[model samples]
Target: SVEGSTGLIASLFNGIKVTQSTMSEVMALIDSSNTKLEYSSQELSNASKKLSESSNLQAVSLEETAAAIEEIASTIKQSSANAQKMTTHAQSVTKANEVGKNLAHQTVKSMDELSNEVNSILEAITVIDQIAFQTNILSLNAAVEAATAGEAGKGFAVVAAEVRNLATRSADAAKEIKAIVESATQKANMSKEVTDKMLQGYNALDDNINQTIGLIEEVANATKEQQNAIVQINDTVNSLDKATQENASLASNISVMAQNTQELVEQLKNAVSNTTYNELSKKRICDPALIFTANKLKSDHIVFKDNNFNNCGIGKNFTVKTHNECDLGKWINAHKNEKFAQTQAWNELLKVHEDVHAKVQKTVDLYAVGASNEEIFTYTKDVEQSATKVFALLDKLREINCENKS
Candidate 1:
């Protein structure tokens, strides 16, 4: 029978080894799976980080493009300003040329009047020459007539010659005046022609000025358009920059989540490694000897009063509450099954609880039956004292079980 007992004990140990090996394998598998999950989370985080970086770069590029657009708009504005100034200058030149043309026209009219006056003076000189010639001829005839009168006739002839020379000089002066007037008229006509050409040139310049104004207006409009476009670009770039910043923030959060996941995986692996169960044979109380020991002190008699000992016609009160009826039913069912009925520790613990209940119930019954408070207290104290011994024994048994598990 000792040999059979030893064989049973050996079999129980073997079962324990098998259970431990199985638990270890499960823990290792959980660790590996956790590691894989953590690695996948980290990969996702890295991808997010890269996407954030790309977004940041795109934001920078957008900003640069916005700045470039702004620069082009500024240049357009400057060109427009220059065009406006040029248009103003062209208009001033055209006005000045118009004033010059007016002055030239007036000068031509004055020159024509001067030429007419010169012609009138020439006519007057011709009339005077004819009168002088007639007078000179009359003087010569008188001189001839007087010749018969000696020296007096000779003096008259000299006077007629001097008068004739004076008339000749007057005629020469009139001819010079006529020639000067003719030259003046030609110059005035040339001046008028030149003024007309200048006026035409001024007209052309005016046309150019108008064209320049139109061009400048076009440039101004273009500049305004460019400015508006640049403003839009700036706004877009700012939005992109903000989005990139948000993306970066999101990436940071994702990275933190990945790291936390890795840590959680490690914690899960450790938790799995720490959890284990004893062999099935050792987990229960199944021996006939243990059953006999537990049944020795069992009683069905119920006490009317509640106490720390004996049956109180009530179910056992657990210190900790279960979640629901399902959990309670499962625990109760498991206990009723008593699959490990040979477990000595379990039998002994149940016996101790039964003994304490019986003692406490007896005290409560005494108190209910008009016993003094001091007597009830003394009886309860003795019952508690016995319960303490039982607790010590249970603690030692648990320690032995822990040592065996280790």
Candidate 2:
């Protein structure tokens, strides 16, 4: 029994090397996990930062789009109203045209009546012309008979001559009146043709106005549909924006948890060391779930108390208690100076981005060449500067869009 107890003690005492070896493996595993967590957290933070920038840009673009749509809708409404007025005026003109057509018809009728009266006058002139010819012949026969009767026939001859002369003058006067009446009738016929053409022109004009009115009504209907579609798009963007903010928050939380887990693993590695590892099984167990943590994400609230932005004017002034969305033209007009400034700042900021990329590449190369942590720290300032520039651009964008606060 004593020999068996001594043997058991020897076996237990010799197991320390095996125990230390197993603990070394555990420490290696913990080191690997910590490395993964650090890399992932850094990547997450970078992505979240970019996403925040994208979300803000989307907000600015969406607000601009919405303001543009509202202005378009207003313009359409005004144009539609003007078209309605034009339609009313066209109807009035059509009525007046009809009245003019009636007057033209009356003029044509009067001309026809005048032409008929002229024809009657021409007929009377023809009768007088024939009578004058007969009278002249009869006068010639009486003159010859008077010459045969000498002195007794002289008085009869003079009387017959005077009668012939009076007939000739009557025929001449009738011929002149016939020529004048024929010319007047021809002019009246031309006048009727002109009046008829005027009536046709009026009818064509009325038709054109009716077609124009129909087109205006169609445009008004289309504008209404576009307004509805834009509203739907705005609602969708807002919902997506909220979801994006939630994901960013979750990423931040994961980063904190990873840092804590790395610290715990460090302690656990020390506990397994041969220097003081006799308390082996007394250590508190870690939850396996910590190795694969995932977080539930949430959105950022819009109406937070510190929701203030700098004024660079694209919409109404943020400081104003009440303001309406501005038109595209007005928004552009408001942001001209700011836009110019942004462009200049962006050029400088772009260099910062390039500089950061070069610095990071150099830092990686230095690490490979056995650079110390203190050496790596020197390059960190360049990264921080890049971050600062990005934030500055973001803040500038915020100020530009603040004027359009919903």
Candidate 3:
């Protein structure tokens, strides 16, 4: 009976050891899970931050593109209006040219009629010359008859001489008038040639003007189409800008949720660490909440950095909390009497934490005053450096805490 009892007792001890070992392994798994969750949350926060930044940039670019398209549309509209005006002017010119062409035709007809009248005058002048020649011949016959009749024919001879003189003067006047008429006919022919050339030139100019009007009309039509297309493009750009802004808002929310999840995971890790079954496990499970808080702070700062101080969750009205008002600072204050607080890492952390807040306040002030992005970026670097130091110091504090707990 004693031997059986000893074996049962030994079996009971073996069972307890196994259970303790399983619990330790479970704790280790939980710790690993917590680490993985923290890492995954951080990665998600970073990704979402980048998405928000890209979306914002896309929105800005789309807005600028929309503005440019609007300007182009306006320019096209003006050009279209000008083209229409030109087309109207060209049409008016075409009408004027037609009127001029008509007038030119009338003038050409009048010149032709004048040439015909001049030709008729030349024929009449020839008839008058023949009559003068016949009269002169009749007068010579009378003179001859008078000479044959002696004294009685003397007075008739004088009247025949006077009639011959009158016929001769008529012939000279007819020749002078013919010369003037011939000169007038040559001038009329030249004028007709010039008018005909002018009429041809007018026709050619009319054709060219008509062609130009057609080209201008085509240009006007094309400009109108381009203006319509630009209007559509501007509408599309505005829609894209709206969508991008929505996307940015969504990304910002996602990043905030990811950070919240990370914080929750840290809390869960802390809760699990408190359930350790051994001193060694207790030492391994030091307070890492400050470390997680530092990580969150860094992630938040990254959001602001990535967003270029525009539309980040924090606004210009955001109050820049002092180090004492921050989570890590509060933790530090609560743990001031602790052994780790007296360490060099704690001192450095305090200094860097204050610097981080100072830089943040400066950034906010710059943003409030409408400072340039370059100026903000310069201060952002300072914040980044201080935040990095704070995180490193927090990690160091965590290590010191583990040692102190051990």
Candidate 4:
């Protein structure tokens, strides 16, 4: 009984030591994990903040674009309306020109009729002149015969001479009327020529007006089509703006959640730290190298060196250089005075880098669930690719800065 009792006591003591050691390591690991979680949350918060800011900028751009589209649409509509008005005016002018040509033709016809009437009047005047002349000649002959019968024929001769004088005056009056009629006929013929020319001019004007109307109508139709297309584009832009707004709201929510996660991780770190208060005297500064170990069981993110990124985390027989992770803290501190941080496109790229980091962080959980080695490799490759994109984006921002200075 003494021997058995002694054996049982020793086994119990050994089991307690093992449990204490396991708990101690668990506490340390939890503290380290808490650090990584805090960093991840802050990174997520920053990324969400950037994403929200980008969304705001995009919304503003969309609003301005929509306004510009509205202005253009207004201008286009005005132009189309003016075109329509011009078309109406052109049609009216064409109709009026047609009327004018008809009037001109009628005027030419009237002028011709007037000329015919004038010619008839001239012919009547000529006939009058001939009759008057014949009358004068007959009266003169009578007067001569009366003179030959003298004394007894004296009164007859006087009457015959008076008749001859009257005929002579009448013939002179007829000639004067005939001369006036000839002048009237000449003027009427000239008027007919001018009226004919006016008719031709009116006809030509009508044809030109018709052609102008056709061209204006075509322009109006084309302008209408352009306006319709622009309206559709405006609608699409509005939809995009709405989507961007929704995205901004989502980013804001993510930022809040990140902040909450950081708080929770801090609490967990404190609770674990409290469990090992007696161990603080022996505690060394946190093993920063341990944070970069390729083992996801200990760390959550890929460790990218200062300048080189191709060899992410670590490989077999690989040694780690003592450097900060991603240089993000330095990058962020330097960004305070850097104009690139304020750039919309640059901030967007930053968000993209953070999003990729988030996806890569998910691999830690996957590894805990016994994910396949191939699956892990695939995720790691994606992280590298995303890191390359981030570097390229930074280069682009530098390019923009250089160009601006130049």
Candidate 5:
């Protein structure tokens, strides 16, 4: 009976030792879990912060894009209106050309008629000259007959001499009139030639003006289409901005939830440290939020690239934030005096961040100067690469923090 009782007590002692070993192991696991939870919570907080910032930035970008689209639409409308006005003016010019051409035709007809009349006058003058010549010959014959009659025909001889003088004067007058008519006919022919050439010029000008009117009409139609496209783009941007704002709100909520979870974890850890064995509160750890800022930055760059390629809208007047103006930049500034700032990783991050902004600025300048898309894209890629390096450096800094904490 004594041996059985000793065996029972030893067995109970072994069971107690095993139970204490299990509790120690459980406590060690709790400590490790608390550490991991703390780290995870910090990471979650940071991710949430980045997401909120990204959402805000996206909203701003969308708003600015909408404003730019509106401005472009307005400009297009103005261009359309100007094109319409030009078309109207061209049409008016064409009408004036037609009127001038008609008047030219009428003037040419009148000139031809005048030339014909001058020719008829020349014919009449020739007939008058013949009459004068015949009259002079008749006068000469009459004078010779009268002289033959001597003194009896002396009075007749005087009358024939006077008639001969009148015939000679009439012939001289007819020659002078024919000279004047021929000079006028020559001038009329030259004027007619000039009028015909002027009419031809008017025809050529009319054809060119009509072509110009057609081109202006085409421009007006294209401008109208551009305006419509811009309006649609503006609407799309507004809608996207609204969604971004909602996402920002959701991020804020998630941040709050993460903080709450962290607090609950702290309480659980404290409770576990106090009790040897008790019901551990089951704490729910939420999934980590995505780091949206990096992706959003990349997306912004892509949009800028597309704008550069398309050569439209805000692309013409693209503007970028300075490194110090971004959320990450501000965070870096806030932590400048921290231990991580003394590390090479932090310095590299700073350099890479600045390089990213510099590259973006360079691309924007290139776009402004109408650089080729390939050139601009090269710079854009540099910016994206720099941005990626900056993030990697940031992760290195976080790792440094974790090592220091350990």
Candidate 6:
């Protein structure tokens, strides 16, 4: 009877175990249905938000495209006007060149006549020099004769000597006049050469002007071509503007699609969150302690300081180095090449050095005018801290940017 009771109890325990397993299976199915419903709702909400942002971006793009088309139109009009003005100026330059060439030719002819006159004067002066040479010889002979004839011939010799002296004076005057004539002749010749060269240059310039006029004509043709090209560009930009509008519309559609995808993913995420498996996955996916440690490592201590740079002209009543003779010396010696060394020295010593010193003196005076040291120190500290924070922020931003890129 005891053995029979034990068998009945075992059968009852097996039935209870089967009933508990069936109930667990039913609960899993209900949870899965709930997850699917939640995911669908979330996906719809995300899709709506994305569509709104995409629409706004498309509107902005359309406006920008229209503005760009208008700008192109204005540029084309301005370019056409400038091209016309250039063409007119080129024509005027051609006419002016022709007139200049004519004037240069007339100037050359006048210079040739002047040169002929100078040559004639030089020939007469040469003849005078030859006569003066003969006179000098005759004067020396008279002086000798006056010495040979003594006493009674002395009076007559004195007259001869006086005549000789008169001749000598005439010869000297002739020589001076010859020198002046030669100088004038040389100058005239030089002038003639210069004018002739100028005439040649003018002729060359005329030829070049003609060639340049041809080039200008070509440029005018090119300008017309450019004008036509600009017109085509305007048309192309208009077309591109229309295309951009279309692209924006397409982008809007793509954005909507992407939003819907995001929403679906979000729903899936929510659905997964509700599962025990998801909870285990989240713990495995991220370590909060590691994240906190990284954040702390990235943080920096910021400090500020401000001072009146009475000597440097940088800020308030800070006694900056007014005369940095050492800096000047260093700057002077900084140049490797000897030629640039002096220049570097002057640049450093004469330019900013003086100005900075002036500024420093001004700052000191400003601080002396009823400003307390504590107040000045506080201000200076504030300024320094502000600069430090700005640099720190910049560094942090760069790190974040680098991380994003990676």
For residues 1-406, write the lDDT of model 4, one tens digit per residue: 1222212242333334334434554466577678889999999999999999999999999999999999999999999999999998988888888888888888888888888888788788778778878888888888888888988878988888888888888888888887887888788788888888888888788778888988998899999999999999999999999999999999999999998998899889779766763243123214433222212211122333211223333232233322123454345445546664577757766676675555455444445556786776566555455544554454455445545544
The best-first sequence of candidates by lDDT reads 3, 5, 4, 1, 2, 6
- Whole-model lDDT, model 1: 0.57
lDDT of 5: 0.72
User: Per-residue lDDT of 197-220 in model 3, one digit per residue for the tens?
Assistant: 888988999999989998998999
In model 3, the Cα lDDT at residue 305 comes to 36
Model 6, runs deviating above 4 Å:
1-70, 91-107, 133-159, 225-406
Task: Return the TM-score for candidate 2, rounded to 2 decimals.
Answer: 0.49
Model 2 ranges off by over 4 Å: 1-40, 131-162, 203-210, 220-406
- Using TM-score, give the best candidate's number: 3
User: How many Å off is the CA of 243 in candidate 2?
Assistant: 7.6
* lDDT tens digits by residue: candidate 5, 102-135: 9999999999999999989989888988888898
Note the residue pairs that clash in candidate 2. Answer: 246-298
Task: Specify the poorest-scoring 10-residue window by lDDT in model 6.
Answer: 297-306
lDDT of 2 by residue, 302-323 (tens): 1110122112123323331111
Output the lDDT of residue 371, model 1. 69
List the candidate 5 regions with Cα displacement exceeding 4 Å.
Answer: 1-37, 152-155, 276-406
Reference-based TM-score, model 3: 0.61
Per-model TM-score on C-alpha atoms: 0.52, 0.49, 0.61, 0.58, 0.59, 0.36
Q: Candidate 4, which segments miss by more than 4 Å at Cα? A: 1-36, 271-406
Better of 3 and 5 by lDDT: 3
Better of 2 and 5 by TM-score: 5
TM-score-based ranking, best first? Answer: 3, 5, 4, 1, 2, 6
Better of 1 and 5 by lDDT: 5
In candidate 1, which residue ranges exceed 4 Å CA deviation?
1-40, 111-152, 269-406
Model 1 worst lDDT window (10 residues): 296-305
